[model samples]
Every structure is written in structure tokens, then in C-alpha cells.
Target: MLKKTDCCQGVVNRKDKDGNTALHRAAAKNYPQMLKLLLACKADKNVTNQAGLTALDVARGQVNNRESINILGVCSFAGVSTLYKLWQLIVKILTEASTEIFQDMDGISSDDRNALLVILGLLLTATYQAILSPPGGVWQGAVFIVAFFLTLGLLKPFPRGFKTALQVLLAFFAICFQASIYPIIPFYFYVPLVINIFIFLVFVIMMSMCTASRVSKISVMVLGCWLLVGVIYQSFASFGS
Candidate 1:
């Protein structure tokens, strides 16, 4: 139909009165294959409809349809912008970490659970402090402290999954704390690297000592191996540079 129509009237890029191309309609309806076909045929993804929305914007607004969003996220012409892509990558990493942490938390003793929480709390405090006072100046730390206390109060009554999700989020923040300062204090690059190494060791040791399921142990070991490989790669890169 597209070939016939294009050969007859060149309607491939033609728009209705609303200025929407076939690409826009396919993206709005979440027809990923159709969108791909249209794109291959040189359909304009950047063209806006009457509402001033491109195909990418239309896909983004379909929050309930993640398939459409993911499809558009990888499209060359309609891909997510740089900042949005970074945000998506962060969310994906944290989500995978949260799943692992949730699995590891199961079957652990109350004491061990409390210990992990304390470590996370301390890490959170350190990260939050780093954020407020990167290297040179000091700002008000009361907000994070108060927020931590409030979180504790709220977490006490929540289910295990929710608590684990919060912990994973805190861990992510703690890990990213050094990255936030790496640009400002490039000379002190090793500070955050050492902190991250310490945090990794603590996590591994805690996981090993805990009474988690066999699957959890395997998951932790897999994560440890992945991190070890990353560390080795970075070490080699640093040395070679």
C-alpha cells in the first residue's frame, strides 16, 4: 500500500490537515514495526503535528506503553536525547540492583538486616554530605539528617520489597556521590574510587556472612565478578593512559 500510494501520488511524507505524517500515527498507536517500516521509507520523525509534537514526543507521552517508549528510545531519528538517555540508563541500573538486593534480603536474620540498614544509612549520610559540600565549602546538613530520620519512621511499617527498593536507591546515590565531585576535584579522583572499593568490599562481606538463599548467594557472586572485571579494566586503562 505504501509503495502503491507513493508511486501513484508520493504520499509517503504527505500529512493530513493536522500536519501529522504516517510516522507520527504509527508511533502514537505503538506500532513499532510499522514505525520502523515508515522510517526505512524516509518518513519524517521530527515533523511535528498540529500540536507541536514529533513522533518521539508522541512516544514519550505514551507512558502506559513502555514498548513504544523503548522502541523510540533506540530509533536513530527519534531516539531519546542525551540527558534523557542517561537518566534511563541510571534507572535501569538501579532497577537491576534493586532486584538483586531484594533477593539477597530474603531469609536473613533481623540482626543482619539491621546491620545492613546501618551501613546503608551511613553511606547515605556520606553521599548526601558530599553532595552538599563537594570539597571546599560546607552547607546545611540538617536536611539530609532529618530526611533520613523521617525515612526510617516511614520504612518501619512498609513491606520488605519497598524497603529493599529504598535501600537500592540509597546505594545508587552513594555510588554516584563520587562521580558528582569527580569533575570539580579531578586531582582527588582516587578518593571516590577508594570509597567505591570499600563499599563494594563491605557489600560482599556482608552478603557472604548473611544467611541468604542459595540463589541470592549466586546472584551476589555474579555481581562481585562483574564488578571485579570492571575494576580490572579500569586499572588497566589507568595504567596504560
Candidate 2:
């Protein structure tokens, strides 16, 4: 039918009311043969629907449809632009969820707030000790220590100037830590380093946005501890080598 008429050129790109083109419908339905036919007809694979999701995104959301995902993966170029869009989507979702959570905190009882404060204090002490007596006794842990304290300050009711200063200082120390580790990271570890840097940046942004929230403060503390542990393990391995 497509070859007999101008349907391949006209109907292939035409979207329904939901903004899904022929390729989008085929991909969502996991119709590999139809998907191939549509692609052969020059269907646009990147056209987003009303939800601003591409065919690839729709395929991904179908967790049980591995065949569809694999088909879409073969057709799509895993380029930087795709990754950037995915990252933007993730940041948007996290920001919205955190903002909603923070906004709903007014109903918290005094007891719960006190409990959170106690937990934060314990985490602060643990982080301080980890800094003072770092794995392999390396002073590189100082960078993380600075970052931890700056993040801790965010949970407190500090002046606007002071809070802004802490945020800047925290970001600076986190970046410094990444830079310092880069020299020691092996060539094969380049990918891991990039991922670590990305996670650090995300953590910094989240901290900046939800500074006074208990959930954000606890998350930062836990992530800081986990990152420190990884750095320590890597340092020890390097020393052994």
C-alpha cells in the first residue's frame, strides 16, 4: 500500500491527535517489521509526542518490551544531544519532586524535626572523623571535608549571604577534589571519572536548591560518605600498585 501511493511520503510523517507518527506507533507496539517498513519509508524517529517524549523514550518506558527497545536503539544514534536531553529530563523530574517535598514540610511535628536534627549532627560528626583520619592517611580527604561542612551549613538557618557563600564553597571543593583525583586516575578509568564528576555536579545542584530540607541534607551526607569510600578504596589500590 505504501509503495502503491504517496502514503510513504505523506502519511508516514502525519501525526495523530496525540502527535505520534507512524514510527512512534510501530515502536510502541513492538512491531519490528512495521518499524522497519516505516524507517525504510523515511519516517522521523525523533518526533516527540504531546508528552515531549521521542519514540525511543516511549520504547524505554515499556519495560517488558525489550525487543522494541533494541529495535529503537539500533535506529537511533547514541549521540551527545540524546544524552543531554535525557539528563535534562532527569534533572527536571528530580527538581520538581524535591520542591514538592520541601513545600509539604510545614506539617512536620516538632519531635520529627528534632529527630532529624539529631541524625544530621551524628552524620556531621562521622564525616568530620572520616576527614581527620582518612583512608591511607592521605590529606586529599580535606577537600571532601570542606565540602561536607559547607553542605551541613545549608541545613541550618543561616543568613542569605552566608548560605550563598557556603554553596559556592561547596561546589568549589567538590570540583577541586575531582581535579586532584584526575591526575591519579588511570587512562582506563576515564569513563568512571566522567560519571563521578557528573554525579558530583548533580549533587551540588540538588544541595543548592533544597538547602534547608532534611531530606536533601541527609542525601548529601550519605552521598558524600559513599564518594569518600570510593576515593579511599581507589587510593589504597593505587598505593599497592
Best candidate (score: TM-score): 2
Model 1 per-residue lDDT at 29: 84
How many residue pairs clash (N, CA or C atoms closer than 3 angstroms) in each of the candidate models, in the order given?
A: 0, 0
Q: Any idea what lDDT model 2 has?
A: 0.58
Q: What C-alpha lDDT do the candidate models reach, one value each?
A: 0.53, 0.58
Backbone clash total, candidate 1: 0
lDDT of 1 by residue, 1-241 (tens): 6543213223566788988888788877889898778766756565667887777788887757577666655655534344444754664565455446454445667776677667757755764665656353222233433443333333433464555566445334433443343344333457446644754654544343222211223334544555566566655654565
Residue 119 CA error for candidate 1 (Å)? 13
- Candidate 2, which segments miss by more than 4 Å at Cα? 1-92, 99-153, 189-241
What 10-residue stretch in candidate 1 is worst by lDDT?
208-217
| Stretches of model 1 off by over 4 angstroms after superposition | 1-158, 181-197, 209-230
Candidate 1, residue 146: Cα displacement in angstroms equals 16
TM-score, candidate number 2? 0.31
